[model samples]
Target chain A: MNYGLRRVLPFFALILICGCAAKTMVVLVPDPDGKTGRISVSNQAGSVAIESPNQATTVSSGKPPTPPVAMEKETIAALFSEALSIQPKRPVHFILYFEKDTALTPDSLKQIADIIAAIRERASTDISVVGHTDSVGSREYNMNLSRNRAASVRDILVKQGVDANSITTTSHGKENPLVPTEDNVSEPRNRRVEVVVR
Target chain B: MKAITILVTVTILILGGSVACLAALDYVGIVKTIAGEVVIVRNAQTIKAEANTKLLKGDLVRTGPNGKVGLIFEDDTVVSMGSNSKIMIEQFLFQPAEKKLSFIARIFQGTASFLSGQLAKLAPNLVYIETPQATIGMRGTHLLVKVD
Candidate 1:
């Protein structure tokens, strides 16, 4: 019996050691919209190496040896098939349209309560407020108008107890339209502010 | 007789200690939502999933005919699995300060949606989702994967 136990003990030990040596692998996929994605991997024993398109990296042990590195991708998919775990949290988005040449519409004003409620429900601190405009205005004019709209929404969110630093505001102007229109066209949905709560 | 009992007790204690240590270091994430019936299998043990149920690396998640499950990673990535689905978290590593980011998952069957987070935003090339038929490398912020 003792001899049998000794043989089994060594087998269990071998199993444990092999399991501990499993390496973590990361697979990169480019974004479909022609945007680039980037990633860098380094370890204590090796210098940092960044992955190019359709590349993979392996990290031994669990601890990372250095700080984050950036890479470029066209369509990005980061797959860490080892050494990590995940849970799911659905993100919420709100689109508030503006009146002609104005920052906020009455309909959008009423939606503020809903936006605030959604933000509070998720208890998320990171939020994005992006503004847009119809093609009715000049490029320069639309840019400034979009910025003003986003800033206004950011201010309201701050007043509703969201952290000022957590909200990032940007303007797409007439570049990315929800409803693509000809020049100088008036599309209500095109002139809007989009709020994404992450 | 007394010596034999003591030997057996010591062996049991050692085995239990090893298991406890493994559990302590194996935490990955928690179940954020569940509908219908969902089960998680890890370390050869299966359990019904509920909100806040902890998940570990190399876990197998399955849903019943009308089930759904959602999970959020430490890196803020979200994964939602639909009914009659089976998925495995093959790997995940997110340490921003150290610049370590990777996410890989395999879908055996059913539908799943992935939303990129800080890791994918920072290092897009490190994320991948695999299916029996094909492997998807995500460069976009969100992807919906379905497997028959």
Candidate 2:
């Protein structure tokens, strides 16, 4: 649509559009997961929120951003081709379950090979292993237990030729659970280590 | 007793501030992709940017006429810009353990893309993008911004 306008107009028309473009413009696109999310654009005048994909809003003349309107795909590509071109691959996440205390379940033990393959495929230099536990034991005890669970995974990967420094292990304890359970409830899903390969 | 309590509080505050200063010395992000003449300005010094180069919190990335750069922050936030663009890495604090999460940047000019990362997923309202005429609060979405 914008290309049509430019094709019809001549030289001086370029300068007429705020000396080449609007003072500020924002275009919301679908997230990596293919889900459209909301975007809010605000200025000295007011705020306008848009939820549709490819919606664009521009704050011209400071009277708040005009109502967000759907933008053509070509317009987005023309404006952001370079930026979109250089985007790095999104990170991938892997979950490994544990049996009791610092020991990985049999299936999870086998999953380490898959995690390593992902690391090699992505040439990932940054990896984070976060451990979580079921809502059992004291918070302080669960925190320590979670750290040990994370260390168990980190140590195995380090022994398997992964860089120790590239991996950061943190203990989330029972604070974050896959399945929300009552205090002291034993949930196997909660005892897990999440590895994010980036 | 009151004076002693005040003295202890002041000492703790000073220690906390120094700890934060020490953390700032760590790299907040790394350049994932670089093409042409992308450069980063840190502490008034301009340095050529390359792939895998670490970006500090206060670094300002500026691109030449044909330059483009992509960066992934510690919390997994991604920022990419086209030629003739300037994006300031003003603030990035992602201490999830302590619940201290913030990501802020200012785009001085040109075209750029921003994708909210783990921090925004954790707390969307804390992420922000500042432009010359407007301030945008990012909410776990992707944005294409142009400042002319």
Candidate 3:
């Protein structure tokens, strides 16, 4: 028994060495019917066909194939190159302001309502509405005017079938300006609201 | 007076021409891998790549170096890399206005996992993965990418 075991040791060692030198190629594929399958091919001097439920397929060879590995590396490099091409642009800010007529007329109200409706339509989760005005009358008067403008638009939106709850309002009475002009000059454009959506 | 007018016209033309050329070369922006390096890349089922190659969206990237690659998508989703592995970013598109993002990656070598963000929550199909031979649609919270 000892003599037989010693004779078989060389054969087992040779098999282990050959297996370590073998290279395998695997391809992962999805099943059409949602079942897993695999097919394996060898780079050795032999070809073997396999059918498995898993879609993963592996081809093993008795010796490692330098050419195929080199090719795979090239393919992966191309993919990396392609993924690096798409990028994002810098954010741009565009400001829009509303004007206050000498007195609120039907046309003016309609325009205000239209602007509010547009803002409501475009209001995303991060929407903000800030009302402002030109330095006119008194500080209190300007503040009231700004608040009223914001509230007025909010009211119009509610009447136009918008969710008033989603809208937030703030007043910046004469703090910001579209154009720097003298007081009481009726800077109509400054009596307005700014809407931002992110 | 005529010579002065001609000189002014020539200067305007030169300035305008240069401005136009520079504008043409202006970069909109580039989406690229913030942390990963491409150890292996090929083309159309072929092997071999040109030197100094650049990667773009939809390109598959397999990295080895203890899988230390990292990537940050436009939507702020972060992906950590693995060692002796392959990860392919299948698709990535970030449009903040519509809150739309598309992202996909595949792994072929070692192990990899992903964390979801705007791309995953907004558009589920945007993220995908592949293993030794399987294309995995990312639906689970987290996954392990490995090839046995």
Candidate 4:
């Protein structure tokens, strides 16, 4: 070949080799009737998992567990690897505020209890209580009222078997109205505590 | 004469390059034809998906009424969407060595089973599913997500 042609040929050859080598996983299956059955496993889109058919072998004594087919092992490996990546390091927390309830009713209490139990079952995290109320009465009166509401919730949670230390209580009375409508009217929704777990 | 020869060679190269690029983007895992509705599955019953549209690879898919669609990703990862449920692929990549994948399926209303592959291990957070109330993150191995 001419000198110019020779230079281009190697570059083309290199590109082809790189392209072929980039594909690593190749799925291959065994022939149903082969002398020594061997299957190649790959992560390619069409790989199928094959299980060995059982044969009637009399077993009165202990027998060693048969090893899985190579393809099965490879497939399992791929799954495990993928699972490891998506696993969450820690459970996420959500905050829920009671909007339209002045006093904790039995149904509301039950719902709160259920939510706490659900959170506990799904994740292990601390729950915080931030209580608030709208502008009404005196500042001191509102603060005590908010604190009482928070404590009442905390006590109910404790009765439900949640550790007292796992809970933190704080009150924001007549200070932070979620809607901030500038009237001295008591908005039932604003007089509530938020449950947050993080 | 040399310029003419070079011109002809350049034209051929340009045409060949365009053809190769288009070919690469053409083959997708699953193509939704006729604009089918995605179902939200719950307790094996399929409901309409929140989003109504045709499905492509990585398209959020759920079972339709009384039907379950099983998906096996390019890397042999198996994810089953429950009836009356919701899910999104979020991200998926399947190359051998440099394989990296991220799938986020928001389960707004039901259950799902996730089985991971090698690429998923490389980037765990790449695959995230957001629901109406929570975001489920995958840990190593197998998991069944039930959003009730």
Compose the digit string of candidate 2's lDDT tens values, residues A1-198: 597676545333323433555488888999788877666778789888878888877776466877887676766887799999998877778899999998899999999999999889877777889999999899999999999999999999999999998798989999889899999999999999999887
Tell me the TM-score of candidate 4's A chain. 0.49
Across residues A1-198, which tens digit of lDDT does each residue of candidate 4 receive? 998886566456434322431121111222123212212111212222222321101101122212232333333233223222322222223333444334774455667756576557744234557677777677788788778778877887778777887676778776767667565777766777766542
What residue runs in model 3 are displaced by over 4 Å at the alpha carbon?
A1-198, B1-55, B65-67
Report clashes for each candidate as comma-separated counts: 52, 0, 47, 22
Q: Write the per-residue lDDT of candidate 3 for residues B1-148, one digit (tens) a residue.
A: 9999999999999999999976554221122232343353534443222221334454555654532454434443545444555666656665533455666566555544343445556566556554433444443233223343
Q: Which stretches of candidate 4 lie over 4 Å from their true place?
A: A1-102, B1-148
B32: Cα error in model 4, Å: 40
- For each candidate in turn, the interface RMSD (Å) is 11.2, 2.0, 13.5, 20.2
Preferred candidate (DockQ higher): 1 or 2:
2
DockQ category of candidate 4: incorrect
Candidate order by decreasing lDDT:
2, 1, 4, 3
The window of 10 residues in a row where model 1 chain B has the poorest summed lDDT is B139-148
DockQ for all models: 0.05, 0.47, 0.02, 0.01
User: Model 2 over residues B114-138: C-alpha lDDT tens digits?
Assistant: 8878888887888888888777888
Which tens-of-lDDT digit does each residue in B26-143 have in candidate 1? 5556677777889998878899998767677799999898788887665567787777878898988865534667888887876576666666776777787765534455554554
Off by over 4 Å in 2: A1-22, B1-26
Cand. 4 Cα-lDDT = 0.47
Model 1 chain A weakest 10-residue run by lDDT: A75-84
Give residue B32's lDDT in candidate 4 (0 to 100). 15
